[model samples]
Each structure stands twice: as C-alpha cells, then as structure tokens.
Target: MKIGVMGAGAVGSFYGALLARAGHEVVLIGREAHVAAIRQQGLQLSSQGETHTIPLHADTSPAALVDATLVLCCVKSPDTLQTAREMGPHLAPEARILSLQNGIDNLAALRSLLPHTVSAAVVYAAVGLAGPGQLEHRGGGELVMAGDALDAAGFRAFDDAGIAVRISPAIEEELWSKLVLNCAWNALSAITQIPYRALHAATGIVETMRAVMNECLAVAAAEGVQLDAALWSRIEGIAERMPQQTSSTAQDLARHRRTEIDFINGAILRRADAHGIPVPANRMLHALVKLLEDRPGLPG
Candidate 1:
C-alpha cells in the first residue's frame, strides 16, 4: 500500500511511520525542515518507551501524493481547503482520503474541494512533534472512522500497522462529541500551558469545562446532531486517559504557531449565534485563544 500523509506534522508523521514500519510504502508531505530531516536520517518515532528511526519517503510537495492509495489529511482545520486544493491534482482517482483532523468542519470543507469520498475520522491520540522529523506519542491511538468505504485491504493494512480503527455510521455525532471535548479543554489547556491532569485538578476548572461543553451541546442539539449520552463522562475522563498530554492548542501556542481554535470552539460560537443560543463560556475561551494567537508575546 502506498500511503501519503498530507501535512505530516505530529499526527501524520506518527501514523505514517507506523504504516511504513508495517512494510507499506509511505510518503510524508510536510514542512521543509521536517522533510529535510527525514530525507537526511529518516523519521524518528518515539512511543511506548522506545525510539526508532524509520526510513520512509518525505517531501514538501503535494506531487508526492500522485501514486498514494490512502491519503491522510492531517492539516490544521484552517488549512483544509487550501491543502485540499494543492493536493487535489496529485491524488489518484481511487485514492481513499481520510480527514484525521480536529474540529467538525474539515470533512465538508475537503469534500467540497476534492472529487472523492472524503471520510472523517475522530482521532483519539496524543501526539506532538518533538523536533523536525521526530514524532513523540504521548497516549491514545485509536480512530473511529466514518463510513464503510474502507476496503478489506485498507483495514488490514491499518491493523497490521498497529493502528486500531473502527467504522461508524454516526460519524457526525462522533465529530460533535469530539468537538465538545475540544471546546471544553483545548483553550483552557492552551491558556494555562498545562497538561490535562493539572488542568482538571485546578480550582473551578471542571465546572468551567462543564459549562463550555453544555453550551457546545446546546448548539449541537440546535444543529440536530444526536451526540452520545456518555459524552460528558468521556470528556471528564480525558484527564485520566492522557494525564500528561497537553492539548494541540497548547502545543500550537507553545510553538507560537496558529491553532484550530476557530474551528473547534469558534464553530460552536458561530452556530450558537445563528441559533440565538448564548454560549458565553465558549465565546470567552475562543476569544482568549484568538487574543493569544494575535498577540503571541502577551505576558501571562
């Protein structure tokens, strides 16, 4: 199997290395520095108390995706449309594209830009780039993929690569549930520059998270998405599941790069406004994150 990971940051590099290790041909389309490091010394993957340098194809050009059978779109939500447009001409006609991204809007955005059945995957992994061409996995590595278009070969390939995956018919609800979690935690983590365990242990944090999540749920209800009843429990349990892991938003802030906050909490804000539902909690978090993005040097 030839797999191309578009925007091969932490998540893409992690999965690409795993697939490559399983004997599949994997190419990572990433930033120049990361691509250069991979070209020089292969991709370095550190996970489960082990580190290995796995050799694979890496490029900064989308043309590297020309022959890929599976394409994982892992770019930030804001870059979805632009990345899709860049990679569109290079994708094989039969290539299976999966949006292994944060937020709820990326699936529709990609489908609109590409001429393929773009599947959505609710990714439950804590990964980050330790450095150029180096991926560090914190915890969790499961994917709940949308739709049944994944063939037997594809499923077997992912399984052989040590990736746990399951297809779900109700992916919209999954995406919303994940979004609710993001709305509840990402900004708080970003602002505090702390891991999930620390944040959850902070004073008044759980109640604040609940408030944000409830606001997001109200918006989800208005949009007619029937999220799972156990979603809140899942959200609260993230602190235990990935105790040392920080939110992707926190990682972005630490790197002084842009975040997907606009799509995560901001998505809720947009819908809430449309539905005339006040989401003050979501709004405050979104604004604070945006303020931080706009003023990266703002003193804590």
Candidate 2:
C-alpha cells in the first residue's frame, strides 16, 4: 500500500517512518530541505535512545500524492484550508484522507475543501523534529478514529505498522476534552516560554488555568459536547506527567513559526461568543498569543 503524509513535520514523519519500516511504500510531502535530506539519506527516526534509518520516498510537491492510497493530513490547523485545496486535486479518487491535526475543526475544514470523505482521528502521540528528515518520538503513539467511512484495509495497515487503532463512538467528546487541555496550557506555556512544570509552579497559574478551562467547559456544553468530569484533573495532571514538555505553541514561537493559537484557544472564544458566554481568560490568552506571533521579539 502506498501511504502519503502531507505536511511531513514531526507527527507525519514519525508515522511515515514507522509505516515504511513495516514494509509499506511511504511518501512524505514536506519542505525542500527535509525532502532533499530524505532523498539523499533515508528518514532518521529516533526513539527510546536509539536511532534507525528507514528508506522511503520524499517530495516537496503535492503532485507526488497522486498515487497515494491513503493520505495523512498532518498540517497544523492554520494550514488546513490551503493544504486541502492544494492536495485535493492531486489525491486519487478512492484515496482516503484522515486528519491527524490538532484542534477540533480540522476535520470539517478539510471535508468542506475536499471532494472526498475525510475522517478524523484523535491522535495520541508526542513527536518532535530532530532535524531535517529526522523524527524523535517521545511516547504515546495510539490513534482513535471516528466515523463509519473508515477503510478496513487501512485499519489493518495501521495496525500492522504497530499503531493502535480503534473506533470511538464519542469522538467529538474526545476532541473537546483535548481542546480543553490545549486551552488550559498551550498559551500559558507559549507566553512564558516554559515547560509544563515551571508553568504550573508559578503563582496563581493553576487557578488561571482553571478559569480558562471552566470557560472551555462552558463552551463545550453549549456546543452540545459534555466533557468528562475528570477533564480538569487530567489537565492538571498533564503538567506533572510531562514536566519538561513544552506546548506545541511554545515550540512554534521558539522556532519563529506560526502557532495554532487561533485554532485552539481562539476557537473556544468564537464558540463562547456564539453562545453568549464570557471567556475572558481564553480571550486574553488567544489575543496574547497572536500578539506574540505578530511580534515575537517582544521582551518580558
């Protein structure tokens, strides 16, 4: 089976390498540097203190996706529309596109832009770019796919690649739950440029997170998704479990790239506005992240 990974950044590269190692034909569509490096030397995958080089196809062009049987749409939320528009014409007619992105709206955003039936996956993974053509996997590599349009062959293929796959009846709830967590920490980590532990250690930070989370919960409720009662606890526990971890937003800022603040926290604010609920904390965080994105050189 031919698998194409669009936006072959950290998450896309990790899965593409693993699938390639499992003997599937994999092609990664990404930047020129990563594609060049992969063309010269196979993708470098590092996990659990070991590194492995896996041979695969790489290209900077969306045209390379024409032959893909399955396409993993892994671009950040901000790039969803453009990616869908660019890749839609190139995707094979029967090809399946699964959104492996953050934020709750990417699935709809892709479906609206593409002609094919797009699926959503609740991705549970921690991957980061080690360098060009390099992916470092930290932990948690499981996937929960939603909807009935899933291809049985695709499920088997992902399973064979050592990726856990399951069908969830309440995928929206799961997504909203994750959104709550992202709202709670991503902006805080990005603004302070600190890891979860340090962010949690700061005075009044946890309470501020609670304030943000309560608004998210209210918005989720208005949106007809009842989040888990343990959501707040899980949000708080993330810091303890991943003490040294920085939010993706923080990483984006550190790299001087665009952050998904608009998609994550900004989504919450939009929903709150529609429902006429107040989300001052979320609003402030979202605005502050945008400010930082616009002028990243701003000092404390």
Candidate 3:
C-alpha cells in the first residue's frame, strides 16, 4: 500500500516510519528540512531507548500524495482547514482521509473544506520531533477511529503494520473525553512549561485540574456529550503514566510556535459561551495560554 503522511512532524513521521518498516510504500510530505533529512539519512525514530533508521520516500510537495491509498492528516488543529484545501486537489478521489490530529472539530473542518467525509482518529501518542527527520517517542501510540470509516482491507493493512487500531461506535464521545483531558493539562503545562508529573505534583494543581475538568464536563454536557466520572481519573492518571511527558502546548511555546490551545481549551470556552455555562477555570487557562501565544518571548 502506498501511504502518504501530511504534516510529517513527530506523529506523522513515527507512524509513517512504522508503515515503511512493515514493507509498505510510505511517502512523507513535510517541511524542506525533514524531507531533505529523510531523503539523505532516512527517518531516525528513537523509542524505548533504541533508535532505528527507517528508509522511506519524502517530499516537500503534496503532489507526492497523488497515489496514496490512505492519507494521514497529522497537522496541528489550527492548520486543519488550510492544509486540507492545499492537499485536496492532489489527493486521489478514493483515498481515505484520516484526521490524526488533536481536538474535536478537525474532522468536521476537513469534511467541510474537502469534497469527502474525513474520518477522525483519537490518537493516544506522546511523540515529539527530536531533530529534522527524527522522532522521540515517549509512550502511547494507539489509535481509535469510527468502525465504518475504514473497510476490512484498511484494517488489515494497519494490523499488518503492528499498529494498535480500535474501531468504536461512540467516537464522538471518545473525542470529547480526549478533549477533556487536554483541557486539564495542555494550557496549565504550557503556562508553567512543566512536565506532567512536576505540574501535577505542585500544591493545589490537582485540585485546579479538577476545576478545569468540571468546567469541561459542564461544557460537554451542554454540547450534548455526557462524559463519565471515570474521565476525571483518566485525565489525572496521564500524569502518573507519563510523568516526563510535556504537553504539546508547552513544547510549542518553548519553540515560539503557535499552539492548539484555541481548539483545546478555547474550544471549550466557545461551547460554554454558546450554552451559557460558567467556566471560569477553563476561561483563565485559555486566556493565560493566549497571552503566552500572543507574546511568545515572555518568560514562563
């Protein structure tokens, strides 16, 4: 199978490398630095303290995606619409588009921008770019998608590549749950520039997280998504499970790049405003992150 990965950052590069290592023809469409590095030195993936160089095709142009059977859209939330528009004309008509991105609105955004329905994937991965064409995987690489989005052949391809893929009927609920978790961690961690464990270990931070989760839950309920009580535990447990992992927002701010906070916490704020829900905690976190975003050089 010829697979194309758009926005070949850490997540895209990691998954594309796995498919390539499994003997699939994978092409990564990304920045010039990454494309040049992969074309020269292959993709260097470091995980579990072991590093491997996986040879694959790469390009800076979306034209490379013309022949892909599947296109994994791995760009950040803010880039979803523009990226989709740019890649739409280049993609095969029958190619399956899977939004392997953050937040809850990317699938809809892509579907509206493109001529086809875009499938959503709830990604549970902690990966970051170590260098050009290099990825550092901390933990978690499972993907959850809608049952009807991928056919039998699609499922077989993913299974053959050793990817953990789950098909669920309640995908919207799952996406909302992930959004709740992001609301609890991303902004706070970004403001403090702290890892999960250190952020949660601070005095009153756990309680503050509870407040954030409560606000998100209220907003989710108002949006007609009823999240479970266990969602709180799952959100809290991420710190224990991935103590060293920092929020993507934290990494983005450190690099002076724009974050997905607008889609994460800021999305919650939008929903809350629509439903007349009071979410002071989420509002504060969202505003603080926005401040940092507007002034990237501000010391954390």
Per residue, candidate 2 scores C-alpha lDDT tens digits across 137-232 of 877788887846468778778888999876788988888888889999999999999888889999999999999999999999898889899988
- Which residues of candidate 1, in runs, are more than 4 Å off? 296-300
lDDT value for model 3: 0.89
**Candidate no. 2 TM-score:** 0.94
Which one is best on lDDT?
Answer: 1
Candidates' lDDT values, in order? Answer: 0.91, 0.88, 0.89
Pairs clashing within candidate 3: none
For candidate 3, lDDT tens digit of each residue in 136-195?
Answer: 999988999999777676777788888899878899999999999999999999999889
Candidate 1 colliding pairs, count: 0
Worst 10 residues of 1 by lDDT: 291-300
Report the lDDT tens digits of candidate 1 across residue range 1-300. Answer: 899999999999988999999999999999999999999999988889998999999999999999888899999998899999999999999998988999988888999989987888889999989899888988888999854747677888899999999778888888888899999999999999999998999999999999998888889889998788898899999999999999999999998888899999999989999999999999999999998898846333
Q: Which of 1 and 3 is the better model by TM-score? A: 1
C-alpha lDDT of residue 186 in model 2: 93
